[model samples]
Target: MLKKRMINLLATGFYTGLSPIAPGTVGTIAALIFALVWIQKYTISFAFILIFVCGGTLISQWAEELYGVKDASQIVIDEWAGFFIAVFGLGVDKFLLAFILFRIFDIFKPPPIRNLQKFHGGIGIMLDDILAGLMANILLRVALNFF
Candidate 1:
């Protein structure tokens, strides 16, 4: 019981995923606040993203079993991981743009990003958002170069 509860907590991004609407966005907002407050260095942010990706995989897989749904909406750890990646190495001033871009990429899942969802289990859950974050990061970098 304790293990399940803990998994639930983490997998749900400390229950931010339990929001009645737009749980993934809520989870991303929680992640953004967390990044703003606690993540000071790019190295630290990268480390957390790695941890979230690896741990998120296991916890998300377990969460799917618990919820009896594949990639359930309540599993928003992926969003947390992705949002962190989207803002990776970006300064505070750029986080809002990163957030917006990440949301767009995540929602639309353009090109290969959408294709990643065909994977099964935890990888399937994590890959799409990971790609979305990477895309957002890349686009943000390009946009910054122009301005």
Candidate 2:
């Protein structure tokens, strides 16, 4: 029971995923606030993103079993992980841009991003968002160069 609860807590982004509308967006916003407040250095942010990704994978796999749904809506830790990746090493000023771009990529799931969802279990749950974040990060870097 405790183990399930703990997984639930973590997988839900501390319950931000429980939002009735756009749970993924809310969870990403929560992650953004956390990044802005506590993640100051690039190294620390990278480490945290790694942790979120690995931990999110395990937790999401368990969440899928518990919820009896593949990639349950309440499991938003993937979003948290992805959002962290989106803003990886970027300044606070770019956080909003990263968030917007991440959301667009995630929602649209262009090309390979959507294809990742076909994989099963935690990898399937996390890969699409991971690709979206990577896309966002790359775009943000290129956009910054031009502007």
Candidate 3:
């Protein structure tokens, strides 16, 4: 019971992911708070991001089995990992822009992002969002160059 409780708390982004509507968005917003307050520089952010991605993946696998559903909406540690990747090295000024781009890419699941759903369990859940973050990062880079 304790283990399940811990898993639920961590995997659900402190229960923000339980929202019936736009839960992923809520999780990402929580991630934005983490990025703004905790992420300071590229080196530190990399470490934190890696830890989060790994932790999310591990817990998500457990969560899937526990929930009897693959990529259950309640598993939102993936969102935090994705958002961290989206804002990586981009600094606070770009946070809002990254958030918008990431949300679009995630929700739309364009191309490979959608395809990543083919994987089962944690990898599937995490990869799709990771790809969305990658897309957002690439687009932000391009936009920054042009603008």
Candidate 4:
């Protein structure tokens, strides 16, 4: 009942995005969950891109209709996918840093990320997060070096 409605409203990832809490914040936390569970199993690189490609394509389409907007904030499958990218290759365990760095990069949307969003459909929906994830991973690596 309620769960289904929330699913419909969120288009899954979108609902996660629309959280009264910062959408990026929730998305990054979700990412940490994924990282903790998944990194133990497969190569984070493969998993990150795979999740990005699959989740972004399906949910972005759902969100387009659900929000009546091309890329609504509520549609955060993008975030989930993107977060995977951020922490993908690093193999770091500092959950808080991963979350913060990922959120910052996602929010800042620097350069290529901001430009990438101009695309429509899956690519536009998904690319920004991939870039954000990469940026976050780099930051994570740098931070790890210091700490």
lDDT of 4 at 61: 73
Give the per-residue lDDT digits (tens) of candidate 1, residues 1-147.
999999899999999999999999999999999888775544435667888799999999999889999899989999988988898888888899999999999988899998898998888999999999999999999999999
- Going through the candidates in the order shown, the clash numbers are 0, 0, 0, 5
What ranges in model 4 sit over 4 Å off?
Answer: 1-11, 39-48, 142-147
Residues 35-125, candidate 3: write the lDDT tens digits: 7767544333677778888888999999899899989987889988888888888868899999999999999998978888899988888
Pairs that collide in candidate 3 are none
Better of 2 and 4 by TM-score: 2
Estimated TM-score per prediction? 0.95, 0.95, 0.94, 0.75
lDDT of each: 0.90, 0.90, 0.87, 0.70
Off by over 4 Å in 2: 40-43
C-alpha positional error of residue 54 in candidate 2 after TM-score superposition, expressed in Å: 1.0
Q: Which stretches of candidate 3 lie over 4 Å from their true place?
A: 40-44
Q: What are the RMSD figures for all models against the true structure?
A: 1.4, 1.4, 1.6, 3.6
What count of clashes does model 1 give? 0
Higher lDDT: candidate 3 or 4? 3
Cα lDDT for residue 135, model 3? 87
